[model samples]
Target: MSETKTTVFRDLLAATKDGDWGKGESRQGHVPAYVIRGTDFAEVRRGCIAGVPIRYLAEKTVHRRLLRADDILIETAGGSRDRPTGRTVLISQEILDAFPGDVTCASFARFLRVDPVAASPRYVYWYLQYLYARGDMWTHQVQHTGVARFQFTRFAGTEEVPLPVRAEQDAIAAVLGALDDKIAVNERIATTADSMCDLIFQSRAQQHASVPMSRLLHPILGGTPDRKNESYWGGSVPWASAKDVVNATVGVLASTEEHITETATQNSRAKTLRPGSVVLTARGTVGAVARMVMPAAINQSCYAFEPGRMPAAVLFHMVRSAAKSMLGMAHGTVFSTVNMKTFDHVEIPNLPADVLNTLNGELASLHQLIVSHLQESRQLATLRDTLLPQLMSGRLRVKDAEKIAEEAT
Candidate 1:
């Protein structure tokens, strides 16, 4: 067994600093940098650094909060009803390289500089992830003004981490890092595939004058079963909500976090769509789009569209482009919602069948690649999630994890 000892969470860190929001635009004495918020933790982990707002900061603060490889960012605030605060993301050179300038955490996040002499930085990051996955971080969170805030000082001052010797830490980190690296590569592959489909759409479909997206695909509604009925939930039927599309790393949704029973589908209005149906979120998180890779039922919050006579990928990107164009139509004080009538204002290429069908084979191939990669990454993430706590708690050996990791990769 690997020898281990309990240590304060703060003791493993050489330093910790709160993040900054700085100025939203460039100004005298303000240097432009990427501000990483707690909201970005999910996207950043998936390797999509695009859309991260660049804030101009005082040069001195930028110097003080400059991020480095192996450093970790902890979310200090920004929790939701479904998700607690205290999420963490590890910084890597590849992520930093994605930005053209300096990178720093946002006001609601803080950076933890690991003490490499005490513990492997990657190992500490994996352990933090394990803790968050197991809901241990919720213990350190408190509500203030209806928002969840992580008690950083309290957590750092009191929480304990089981620490193994430096050598064992390195070994454990290596095993976990291998899994994440592969997952990251797969994510990149999936995103690139989707981008290729979009590029093809632009090149081939742009010449057409205009066609209302609604003319091609009709909106189909989804449903939710009674919450009080246990049999209605958690079955083989993949039940998708807006979050499933909003959080997808790639444009392909091969699986969902929640599933429903066939009984739920038959008893309720939740109609199941066949594979290749493109689902666009119509409420709350409106405009988020994904193509279903399997037969799935959706909730009322989403609208599913069949490919009809056109290619699935073609329809997917067309709907995505139109939804983005008509985003202003989705409006509400509480939850942003979209109506089918908004599509009349949204225009897409009116390309003829001869030109459109020519690109169908290639687009379908790319979509399939995206689906396969996403499905594979999902499985890899499952393996990592399963192994994380076992390895962190010293219940599973690094060598044993390495064997499983090797088999998965």
Candidate 2:
């Protein structure tokens, strides 16, 4: 039997300096740097670019270091106690260039430099990813600490990584990288879908005179059941919040983080959200929007629009165009809240039925394309995840993997 070798990560890697990567200035004159935290990955993947300053980094302390193309960034803390810690991201040249100087990572994020001689950078990337696969380990580790967090000392010092021969590492990394390459292709398809939708919306909005959102559609407020009632949750109905609506790129709204019982649905102000309902975030996320492709339920934080005269697709277009101005309606000293009155005041240029239908058809087609790519990406991810541990631990042969991948196509 081959014996397992133990090694300290400190011995295997060098440390990072303060300037290795710095946070960008909060603001450039009146503009602010778009700082992306761990949770911002999806949004960043969306229309939000890396350096487009929504907020300024100028007032905050600015560091001078920059992240390298090959460096690995780990999020040491985030999310709930039951969730995992130490989310790692491989920094790329594109990300580095976009988020230039004063562009900094959080203090909790640690940068690691792997020795190329012992392990390939790509190999290290896959290996570190596999270690965090369980995710439960982090929850258990931080259980006693009260707050869930990824402490650098505990993570780097204690985690036992399976180190193999350099050649073996290269082979494993290659297989995983190929899978990622396919996923990237799918992502481009998703991007194209987004671009197509953007073109239609922009063209229509520019041609029509901007009006208050109220002229577009009828508003139906969502409601939440009493949480104290056990029957209020854990049923089949998807009880959506601002977070769910904001993430959806397609017309479909199938599920949510929480669910509600039939009894709860009957008791609360919550209504059965049908397919074609235009859901808009009224609180928390504020003006974010999504269209329901399936029957679901939404919480008080979001508003559902059931089209009266306009087709569901046309209403979606109108809502998307008015999102920015509608968000501005809500004002608060601490937290922002959007009332129905505010939504009633917003408007969109009314288009002829034929024109609205044409535009709606184009958008629906684009959304369908995006959803297809998204499904493909999900499948590729699942395959990569399934093979990750096997490849890393020598259970799967690289040659066999190549054959399987070829056959998959």
Candidate 3:
């Protein structure tokens, strides 16, 4: 093992700039650009940027703040008490390739450009992730007002970064990067499988009796556990709100931002949902549906349906189709308030056993493959997270870490 030195975090940065969110519409001096908010960091890290908002920015600002490959975007503002604000995402050419125009972080975030010779940019980004994971970034966050903010200047100038030599940095990054590359490959495959399953369901779900939506799903009512009681939250059970459902782009809800205790559910209206249940948002920005991959619960804004004796992929697309019809009715005569009675009036086609059963064999096999990829990605992610801090701190040698990762792979 070799000894490593430390450097002031800001010293490695060649440049840093605050971001801009200009007028929504095009101005004389402004051009259209995709704005990356703190919220988009997770998806952007995964190589998916579909939800990154588009906003116009002054041409000069865009030129000055334009994101390049290897830059790091930090969330300088907007975090809750539980989550710290110094969240960071590494920019890549792949992310830029997916976009049509230039990219910039929103006003709430800032971007850092590290001189590659001074520090490996990917290594620095992973160091920040390591910092956040182990509660080192929490001290940088302060809540004087409503939104918690990260003290960027102080954090950069005062904090010492564990600096390994360039060769060691690259070696460490390469070992971890291989795992991420696998995760990205899995994501793309699962996403394609999701698309194929949707097409299969749409093509086959026809010529059936139209029954009230309630009969098929028997919609389990979702309710919130009392928030003030600390015992009610942050347990093993995943809890889905409307936001969770809407954010699930591939029709699979693998995790949630919050969790509730099994005890909380037993004491409150929140019910524990069975695995393979299809969850749908019934109110507020409606019509998003996803199959819960694990045992979970939901808040009042969503409904959970156990996919009993049917392929959950079938229910996933069906509920989305039903939600669209229900939303259409709401737009016409019914108001925004959707309830059990609302589901009763709006009919959904019965799952014709023969047709869906035949389709079921195909869809179930495909859905299982997607879920398998997701599970593998998750396990790889856990291994990567475990290896990170030890590698960054020089506690785990890059060669030894590679051996562990090889075994996992």
Candidate 4:
């Protein structure tokens, strides 16, 4: 590998602009727009940027400031105690197409358009991510009151980036982009499979008799482990909350953000739900559903449905189809919640034994395929992340990285 030249960030950009800060009223049947605050920066992983679907009405002026392909979106403000400011995502045509109309980030965000002759926007985006992973982004953050803000001027004017030739930059971006492309394709496959299963189940279920949920499954309400007890938290057991179920786009949840100790599960009302248990958000974010891919404990805000005679696959989609009804049952001033009575009153279609047996076999096969795709995506993501820093730093040649990336895909 040849030595890569370095240049200040300001020298590589053709333009830099902060987004519009104006607020818009929430009205019915308006144009959809996105803001930086809505971006799920926490869950964004290598090669995958989560799109914010929440839309608000914005003026035509705001639409003019919408993001373009190859532009880099940077989170300029807002930092948590654990994560500092300065996370960034590269805007691609695919991401732009996901939005119904023109998409733009909030005023708290900024866009950097690289000078085509000087640098590649994709390269700059990857380089910024490399800096973030190395904790260098924190050095460029300015503490204002309690909030951490990115020192955009100082960063743009002073922060140095290793610049490879344009061809090399393109090659690196292509190699990394391939892995991401594969991951995206796998995600689409899984989503399509889930939708197909839902359609199949719905068609068969319409002919069946409506039976009470109690007859199909036992709904076990969750309880909180003592938060103050240090021994109760942070164990190997996955502890799921309503947030986990709400954030999950897929039907199967393999893990959660928090976990609890065995002692905590034994002491509190929390119980370790079996792998096939159907978990749903019963309280705040009511009706969000997912199946437990592994044994896990749930928090008070969620409900775990233990499959009785019904297959887990059937119960999962049944709960999903009933989401609207569950939401209707939710009633609270501050937070919507569904109680035991809500579950007891709800009924699901009971398919014939022979029909159910055949459907269950088909659903099992479909779910297995989805799970396989999910696993492959995880592995591809790992490969991409591992190669990111090395490629950005010029320690690994693009050709060599391309070979590895292509093999992974």
Top candidate on TM-score is 1
User: Taking the tens digit of each residue's C-alpha lDDT, what string does model 4 give over 1-409?
Assistant: 3657889999988877887654465665556566544256433333234455445655556656677888887888887777878888777887666655666667778888888788888888888888888888888888868878989998888998887777888888888878878887887788889989998999898988887666676779888898899999999889999988887657778778999999998999888988878888977777899988899999889888876677878878888877767787776878888777776777888787788788888888898888889889889988988999888766787888988887787
Using lDDT as the yardstick, the better of models 2 and 4 is: 4
Stretches > 4 Å off in candidate 2: 1-6, 17-36, 41-64, 97-104, 136-148, 209-211, 249-255, 393-395, 400-409
Superposition error at 198 for model 3 (Å):
1.3
Q: What is the lDDT of residue 263 in candidate 4?
A: 94
Question: Which digits, one per residue and each the tens of the lDDT, describe model 2 over residues 340-399?
Answer: 788667777867777777888877777777667767767777888888877777788778
The 10 consecutive residues of candidate 4 with the worst lDDT sum are 41-50
RMSD of 4: 3.4
- In Å, residue 336's CA in model 3 sits off its true spot by 6.1
| Cα lDDT computed for each candidate against the true fold | 0.86, 0.67, 0.85, 0.79
Better of 1 and 3 by lDDT: 1
Q: In model 1, which regions exceed 4 Å deviation? A: 228-231, 328-336
RMSD of each: 2.0, 4.3, 3.1, 3.4
CA deviation > 4 Å runs, candidate 3:
206-212, 224-249, 254-268, 283-285, 309-311, 326-337, 345-347
Better of 2 and 3 by TM-score: 3
Candidate with maximal lDDT = 1
